[model samples]
Target: MTPTLILAIAGGVLIAAGIYLLLERSLMRILAGVMLAGNGVNLLFLVASGPAGLAPIVGEDPELIADPLPQAMVLTAIVISLATAALLLAMSYRSFQLEGHDEVADDVEDAIVRRRAEADLSSEAYVDTSTDPNDDSDSESGGRFDGGRVR
Candidate 1:
């Protein structure tokens, strides 16, 4: 296989693995996923830039010189990834200090909301008491808004 194709495949695999790791609740796993994805992106950028050539300096033929845009983009992505990794590390550290573990806990409110939705029950805050049979405004249309008010 061509070198470009091989690199592309490797990049794809790395991205896929990173996405899988990102689905986990562990912060460390997420950090690794981010790093993997970032490197994969950098690899893809290199592949997209085509084969390496002379540096894009003066006196070099423009056609023979490699594009610098992709390199610049990869650098920017690396910086962003680094920032994100640092943020996640800090968050995980704080979580460990407070909870003694880095595993993320499910939110109680989200579970309650999910249960309510599954049971087809509306929250008390949004319950409409008007029982006009002629008014079909509140039919099960998934919360349509009319005239700046929820129907």
Candidate 2:
């Protein structure tokens, strides 16, 4: 097959796999997915930049000069991707150190916020802490909140 067709197919596969991995809960998988997506983007840049040819030097044969901008942008993108991957790896390591596993965990505070928001969606006002002088959520939450509101 032509090189262009090959690159297109490879890029498509990489993007698909990257998306699949990104949807997973594993940090390692997410890192891999980001890398794959970066590679796919690089391949797309290659394809968009057109066929490689002789350098675009002045006074040379006026035929088939490759644009250098896309190549330069792709290189910059590669460096950025590498930096991002390294950062993600370091964060993943730190997370693994703190928690026994690298799986993404739900924040209890976020869950509580969601529950409260859902409760507020109903027209019936239940346990309005602002007016209720005897709210117990603050006492039950181990002093995590002050004046019946989360701190």
lDDT of each model, Cα atoms only? 0.85, 0.81
Cα displacement (Å) at residue 17, model 2: 0.8
* Predicted structure with the largest lDDT when compared to the true one: 1
> Which lDDT tens digits does candidate 1 get at residues 60-119?
888999899999999999899989999999999999999999999999878877776787
Indicate the worst ten consecutive residues by lDDT in candidate 1: 142-151
Clashes of each: 0, 0
TM-score of each: 0.77, 0.72
Q: List the RMSD of every prediction in angstroms.
A: 6.8, 5.5
* Structure candidate 1, residue pairs in collision: none
